[model samples]
Target chain A: MLIAKVIGTTISTIKDPTLTGRKLLILRQADIDGVPFGKPYVAVDTLDAGVGDLVLTAHGSSGRQTEITKNRPVDAVIMAVIDHLEISNRVTYRKE
Target chain B: MLIAKVIGTTISTIKDPTLTGRKLLILRQADIDGVPFGKPYVAVDTLDAGVGDLVLTAHGSSGRQTEITKNRPVDAVIMAVIDHLEISNRVTYRKE
Candidate 1:
């Protein structure tokens, strides 16, 4: 699952207690017609998407399917926030 | 596992009653050619990657590498910081 667009954020008060209080953003990968690909990585958010919102990004193990990242030191998470996005049928986004 | 970028970020006063403090960033998909395709999306960061930093993100179960994210609710996570990236017969980005 990939359709991103939240372009900035990085904060760390010394990490690695299994990544205590996770929150780091920086993604730029969009496909399925919207365009804007390549270069830009960093994911660790569980919904509550903002900053140009067009969400619904879950990769690998389904980004853990959240129960607050299910098991532990999380990966990518944003379950769902996209209301409408069509490719061949058009209607790229419609979540007003 | 796509080649990703960092164009921006977002945050809130969270702390995780599960993930009350997970920071979110937007992302767009990129090909190995270093071309920007699609629109934009998001990812949860694992490293202190910068706006221009190319990272190695883990998908599915791979995102659950770290002890923090091991066997948890994570889906995608940055496994390596990408010291240098090469695609075909060339060097994409190297460690400075």
Candidate 2:
């Protein structure tokens, strides 16, 4: 899993039928210091994460393991909302 | 899905039991022109792609959708081997 911040939501009127009713959020990958990096991409939200919320994102088929995404064509999914993150025993980010 | 090239293999003696007997290939993301880009990462192979083979890779939970990867903890999987790739009506790569 990778750390990311939900940036916004995406709505498409015409898309795969399986994607209907799924919450698609824009995610910006974040480094340990909570700084955003890499290109922003769309991710299916499974944990009710909101914009500005730090999330743990699973990529590839693991994104489909969630009940809501099973058998869907999604490639990325938000699996958990991060409360805090630590590296090398040092706290790096704390969700507020 | 994204295009990538298998670069090598990975062996782990200690890993999730579900991952046993699964072939793990290292993949380098490639652009439409077949030029490698971005950081290399590991991906489970479902299509028997070999090192240097151009492949289509699915990320997130979609990687686990394959029969061999179902219920596994993997995040990336190679789903198809490319015979050729075209962009703007021009062939960019053709398997030799």
**Top of the candidates by TM-score:** 2
What is the Å distance of residue A46 in model 2 from its true position? 0.7
Tell me candidate 2's interface RMSD.
9.4
Candidate 2 per-residue C-alpha lDDT over A1-96 given as tens digits, one digit per residue, 9 for 90 to 100: 456789999989999999889999999987655677889999898767889987756676676767778889988787656565544345666777
**Candidate 2: tens digits of C-alpha lDDT, residues B35-87:** 77765556789888887789998876677788997786567788999999988
lDDT of residue B14 for candidate 2: 35
Residue A93, model 1: Cα distance from true site in angstroms: 14
* Local accuracy of candidate 1 as per-residue lDDT tens digits, B9-89: 533232234433443444455566444455555555766665555666666677667655555444556555656667687
**DockQ of all predictions against the true structure, Cα-based:** 0.12, 0.11
CAPRI verdict (incorrect, acceptable, medium, high) for model 2: incorrect
DockQ of 2: 0.11
Worst 10 residues of 1 chain B by lDDT: B10-19
* TM-score of each model, in listed order: 0.48, 0.54
Please report the candidate that would top DockQ against the real structure: 1
